[model samples]
Target chain A: MEISYRDMITVLHGMGFGVLFMLAFSGAIGVIYATAVVGPHWPRSKWDNAMFRFYLISMAALAWLATISGAYIIYPWYRAVPPAGTADLSTYPRALLLSNPHTAGWHDVGMEWKEHIAWFTPIAMTMVAYVFIKYGPRLALHRQMRNAVLGFTAVAFFSTAVAGLFGAFLNKYAPVRGGPDIVLMREN
Target chain B: MSVEQQPTGSGAAAILAAGMGSLALGVFAFAGDAVPALGRAFTFWQPTGALSGVTITAIAVWLISWFVLSRRWASRDVRLGPVNAAAFAMLAAALLLTFPPVMDALQGK
Candidate 1:
């Protein structure tokens, strides 16, 4: 209800990351779908092409929502503290569970989900990529699909680049504030 | 090019109906944040409050656009081409940019 500057910035930033995450993830999946999944079993009609396009668009939207719920909240929270190897929060006053690994439970849940999604992201994208590359070129209605793929792929690359830059920025400016190692450790 | 006959009246009616329906629902979804009685009933519609409003408004915008486009290009195979792709990417990018990454940056790794 109350919109502070900080909240505004957070929402805006989260939205950006959410969109970036969706575009990149969808693009990557389109590539995989084209080369892997759809190549051999490519469709043969206009209906099929339309359906595939619909599928990709829907999937992209799903990835956007899922990643937003999982990553934007959890990843940022997890990063609030420095990496475990570099620093320890065990000595802090009241030993806030936000920083404490021993007592907190849900703290790691978000990060775990975030990491889990991150891990599976490439696999899912591969499936999407297959659709784009395979059916994309051969559609009777080639123009729309082709244009979509080109746009999708461009976002895939650009967003990934931007993500890396943001990653680096976090490393320098915010630095990892330590928290429970539940999710990170479990994934590794 | 296969030319499908455009929907002259029924299609326009359908689009209008769908657009208005979506717009109404979206409005209802957000009405709770302001009105106390509606707020109680609809608060559950969106646990997160304002975020739900944003979602409703965004969806309504898209639906309205779709309705207009459908009316304009009814029955004709929508000529989706590179332009659509570029436009979609740009739109997505603009939306993404507004989702400032700094907070996520501060919150988690």
Candidate 2:
């Protein structure tokens, strides 16, 4: 079936919005798991550790949401009046991909936003600093709590990296493996 | 200080293992035939972009760090101190540099 630019744009927008919702949904679910369902059963040390990490997770989630939101807006603007085809040819695949409508679109927008999620390392780092400021120097801080913090941080770090590859996979075969530009140029 | 103390080496080793595992998974996800199916867990659609070497490196680092920190062997327990702090800062800087505002200035975005 032929897809219109408008229709393709809609699908792209829907996918982008879906990811945003996923981020929100996952963030909320994680918090709920940490709080209502499992918070009470957790040891005090774990609770404190989790609470500390939770703030960081929340911050990182917001950062991701913001980036995706930014792309969702900026991308359209970029597409609407993209750089004129100087017809200049070069080797920068990344640059080429960015300028090419065939490669760059709402789908690309979604993929690119996912790609940038790794940017939250600073937030995570800042979070670590916050933990140190609030809980550090107190040598007697619960060992279990400390370990829990370490574990949570480790998990968060692990996930960030894992998510990167996951994002890559989606980008590599978007709209089906090696599919033509039919999806991009298809009319409604 | 106690015998029950976690060997720092083990932690680092664990991190390393995690990194390797992720790398392998990524290789399959990006290059292997089953990539399409595996990629579905993360997204409804598959990715068509190139695999990122930088991201792979980051995954390796995390894995190595975990392996070193979580190991039970002769403890090399490195504290999540200045080093990790510094690393995080650098990653953040790289991220900000890629933002559209920054890209615009550099590429005239």
Candidate 3:
């Protein structure tokens, strides 16, 4: 069973947008935590606290889901296709799918780094969630604790940004040159 | 330090969970790159090392650290603050382990 290039493109594009959304939410947690409170003063109100909680949990979930989904789809596809140099000519289509043919710049290097580090984003995000959920209202009253949570969220935001950037870079450079760009085997 | 809510058993659990999550990610990446490579090496099958060797190494680094660090403070309750160091280490080690593969891709070797 194979897919058309159009469908492949669509899947990649959809994954990209999903990751962007994940980044936005992850960043939102850090931004909100910073200016909103420094402890002592506590949350502005119950409403504000509720909203903050919502964003924190959402960021955690979104980042993990996006990270897992992207890893699931992209890495496996690369694995399935043997490199043209390593495999026979009959396996050209697999090798020609995502990776670039020539090493002009940081294209491949940047992506490999991105894929590896991106794994930890979910773990970091989980810490963000753990700190927020277990501590609860106390986080608003204690300045030091608040800062710790802030640091975690900030880290989360940074990692997600890195992942998103590398993912886009890889996508832009995918498709081997001087080879069949799309090998359609009927779209299902 | 003055806070009443300091040091609890739960912190270690949370930190451990994070470490495990990192381990899972690393292992998955390794498996992704390894399976293919293994098949190609052994049989006519063009196995492309489904698991990434880099990721496996990263996981080993993480697991060892988790064991060593937990032992370092096994008697005392793990605080979130101190555990941050472990988290950071795990994150850094993961990225560092994967550097070679990325370089290979960039060099097109």
Give the top-scoring candidate (DockQ): 3
Q: Candidate 1 lDDT, tens digit per residue, A70-116?
A: 34443444334344574554322112344546533322332222222
The DockQ assigned to candidate 1 is 0.05
Interface RMSD of each: 11.9, 10.1, 5.5
Q: Across residues A46-100, which tens digit of lDDT does each residue of candidate 2 receive?
A: 5555554565555455444533433343233222322456463232224445656
Backbone clash numbers for all candidates listed: 38, 43, 22
What ranges in model 3 sit over 4 Å off?
A: A1-36, A82-94, A97-101, A104-108, A140-148, A175-188, B1-8, B19-81, B101-109
Q: lDDT per residue, candidate 3, B1-109, as tens digits?
A: 1223544344454555455556555544544444565423333223323334443444455456556655665456555565556555654544544565643444465
- Every candidate's DockQ is 0.05, 0.07, 0.25
* Candidate 2 residue spans exceeding 4 A from truth: A1-113, A118-188, B1-54, B57-74, B104-109
> Model 1 chain B — which ten-residue stretch has the worst lDDT?
B7-16
lDDT of each: 0.40, 0.39, 0.52
TM-score of each: 0.37, 0.34, 0.60
Q: List runs of model 1 lying over 4 Å from the truth.
A: A1-62, A70-72, A75-140, A175-188, B1-60, B67-74, B79-109
True interface contacts reproduced, per candidate: 0.08, 0.00, 0.31
Cα distance off (Å), candidate 2, residue B24: 17
| Model 3 CAPRI quality | acceptable
Q: Rank the candidates by DockQ, best first.
A: 3, 2, 1
The docking category that best describes candidate 2 is incorrect
